[model samples]
Structures are given as C-alpha cells and as structure tokens.
Target: MAGSVSPRFARWLAFAGWALVGAGYAFGVLSLMSIGVFVLAGSVVLTLLVRRAWGRGGIAGLVSGLGLPVLYVAYLNRGGPGWVCTTSGPAMSCTDAWNPWPWLAVGVAFVAGGIALQLRRPAAAG
Candidate 1:
C-alpha cells in the first residue's frame, strides 16, 4: 500500500493538514486552533520520519488531514465551545466553555497519529 501511494499525495496531505490548522486558528477557535497547530506540527514530523524511512513522507499527513476534521467534529459534539471574547460577554460563560477534554483529545490524537506514522513500515520500493 505504501508503494501504491505517491510522495506528492503525501506532501499534499501534509499541506492540507497545516492549512486546516492555520484556518482553525485564524477563526479564533483557540481550542481548535491549538489542535490544528499540534496536528500540523505532528504532520510535519511524520512527513520527515516517513521521508527518512521510505525515501518519502506523507502518509501521516494524509491520515492527519483526514482525521483532524473528524476529531474536531467529535470534540465539538462533545461540547466544544465557540470563541468568546471575554467572560463578560453575553451568552459566553468561561466556566461552561472551559472544559479541557477537547484540547486533550486533540493533543492525544495528534500524538497518537504521529507515533503511528513514525512506527509504520516503510513503503515498498517500486
């Protein structure tokens, strides 16, 4: 399967993962942004690891790019909050939105994905 995947595809996946993270951050969803950054960074590391092991990098990128969104949605469903400017803002209570599970989940996912990619077997040579 590794031999069947193209390096270019992997690079694109990595690029997409980073792009999602940047977009999430730019939107001011701090938790999501943090998740994105973590995932993006992990994707980069995975790319490097894969490159070194298989003479290419990107499987992690692809997995991350596809997985982050799913995880993000899951986190949201589990009560992820929207960005709030201040505790004083109407309809924005810090206590209600301050749950740490989302962040933890994202971090764990990023780390797990990175570790998995790093440990994966090298792609078979053509």
Candidate 2:
C-alpha cells in the first residue's frame, strides 16, 4: 500500500473527505444527523477507493468536502443580505442567518480542523 503512495497523503485525503462532509452538515445544507451517516458511509467508500485507485479517493473527497460548502455559501448569499425562510409562522430576517463574523469563524474552524487532521496523518494505511 505504502509502496505506490505515501501514507501521509492518504490520511490527508481521508481527513479532507470527512471535513467536506462535516462542513455540509455544519452549515445546514445537509442535516447534522445525515452528515454523521455520510461520514460512516464515506469512510468505507474512501477506504476502498484509496486502496485500489491510489489518489482517487482524496480527489473525490477534496471535491465533495470542499465543494459543498462553497456551493452552500453561494446559494445562501444569492439573494444578498436577507433570509429566505421556508417555514411559516413568524418572518425571519437576514440577521437570523447573515452574520458574517460567526459564519466566518465557523468556516475557519471547519477548514482548520480538516487541515490539522491532514497534517496529523489521520488517514494513513488505507
């Protein structure tokens, strides 16, 4: 396994996969519980892909993990400075969800955790 690819790289990929999926849940695009299930499922799939295809798992994980958050952010901000509520009861304002500082902090935490795990080599050995 380590003959063709570095274990450190593999771990980084796995961590990236987990992070991507985690961010999606964190931002509410995907429910928190759903993300938990995705992590378990993604682990098995990524393990198999890493074992057989070398860098494919990492690439996929990177794409999905990183892509989802970007997409979600774009979607959320599409209307610009306002909250689009799907539920009816009381009207929700942009202030309810458009706080830049807190969201930025949350994003930093998610990306930082991913990078830290990658640096720590958590996904080594397929």
Candidate 1 Cα outliers beyond 4 Å, as residue runs: 1-57, 66-95, 123-126
TM-score of every candidate relative to the true structure? 0.30, 0.42
The parts of candidate 2 lying over 4 Å away from their true place are 27-71, 78-97, 121-126
Q: What TM-score does candidate 2 reach?
A: 0.42
Residue pairs of candidate 1 with colliding backbone atoms = 51-56
* Colliding residue pairs in candidate 2: 11-123, 20-65
For model 1 the local lDDT of residue 50 reads 46
Residue 34 in model 1: shift from native, Å? Answer: 20
> How well does model 1 score by local distance difference test?
0.49
RMSD of each: 11.0, 8.1
Report the lDDT tens digits of candidate 2 across residue range 4-99: 666666555555655544444444444445565665565556556544644443443443354446445655654545554554568544433453
